[model samples]
Target: MSSPAHAIYSSTLSLSLQGHAFHPQYGVQLIFNEIAESLILCGAICSQNPSCRTFDYDSSSHRCRLFEADLTNGAIIAAASQTSIVGSVILSASLYASMYNQSCSACQENRYQTCSSTTNTCQCPGNSYWNGSMCPLQLFENAACSQIDACRSDLNLSCIINSYGGFTQCLIGINLFTIFVYENTKIVQIETMSDYASLRSNDGVVSPNYNFLFDENILE
Candidate 1:
């Protein structure tokens, strides 16, 4: 149906945590039937049910659980063979039509504003190099990043540990191999502290080597 001129609806489809599952206590159980066949179907069910907000699907079990709200009270822990489906409503066919026609001037009004088809409004686009409040600029080496995905991955950019002990910038990762060698003492220890560790990359920053630490408790 056609909405009012310039009418905006806001919603988004999030696949960011697709492979993970939400905690059981977070969402309300609306239904647990064979009717919920797939994640797509679960989303549709949520849309149909006005009270539904989020849903979780067990791919292996083919079980679907719809929630009246999102993950607010509990943590969304990762689960094997589970997929979480979160969707927003604020979309209309008219918005898609407008985007296709290129009649959307919302983006042109400002350099930071991009047409959000789901919301039918002009807002910052995803992965546009986040600014303080809005993402108007592209991220460069050493630029602050809230999450790993916030930085450009196509350029082999990685959000790793900074000297400050916090993830703040995007830097190129250095590849290093840790081979076990028998020294005169015959003791095996991980070591990357060498003069070669200070090699400069395109960003003129020292590449950090990461070594995997073995934990005996993990075997349990």
Candidate 2:
């Protein structure tokens, strides 16, 4: 293989798996593939592409494959050949600014909405929820929630009052079941779905003071 031209290794890349390679599975997609004489050449090619998030370099074949894959997007299976290395780009680095050279649609100049490294669109900075047209401020998925919109809008989670009695509206003749809530104002424990039909068989009073909260993660 011919040696690759001397190019400065950009500080925006990080090695994920050394001496390891991955092949596309059934539904995997790739940005492009090319003959790369060295690992540096493979990474340089990935840096040149805006959508290239990962790259795999095969030492024996002198080939490189660029992909939009990432740890959160999905996992790639390892190949039988162990003479390769895999690297991923840092989304939060200055490289992102250069990657998104083109202007994003509907992105206001001074709205604090930056370009999303994953979606390549204009969205709220630091994982804020984007509501298509604009980024609406929202709480984290694992944080203490109070209102129905407490969690990220993308998650589409239901708001259940923790430490409350039970969901009176959840029960209907034979089609519905009672959902019991906890009584702790500051719910620090995980709440499970408890269905009791006998307790409130008929019309029951709904508690006015439904406070405390529990996310879908802690619910079973």
Best by lDDT: 2
Which candidate number has the best TM-score? 2
lDDT for each residue of candidate 2 in 15-107, tens digit (9 for 90 to 100): 756566645431334768889989988988886654466788888898899875565444555666677788876644232232222345443
Clashing pairs in 1: 9-119, 10-119
Backbone clashes in candidate 2 total: 3
Q: What TM-score do all the candidates reach, one by one?
A: 0.31, 0.40
Question: Which residue segments of model 2 deviate by more than 4 Å?
Answer: 1-11, 23-28, 93-220
Candidate 2, residue 106: the lDDT equals 40
Error of 1 at 75 (Å): 3.1
lDDT of 1 by residue, 1-220 (tens): 2133322222333543566655544222333335466767765565545334456666667677655334432345677764544343332333332332132464443222355464444443443432223332234456676433344454555454443434567665532223232334443332232211111111122223322232222110
Predictions: Cα RMSD each: 17.3, 14.6
User: How far does residue 70 in candidate 1 sit from its true spot (Å)?
Assistant: 1.5
List lDDT for all candidates, in order.
Answer: 0.41, 0.46
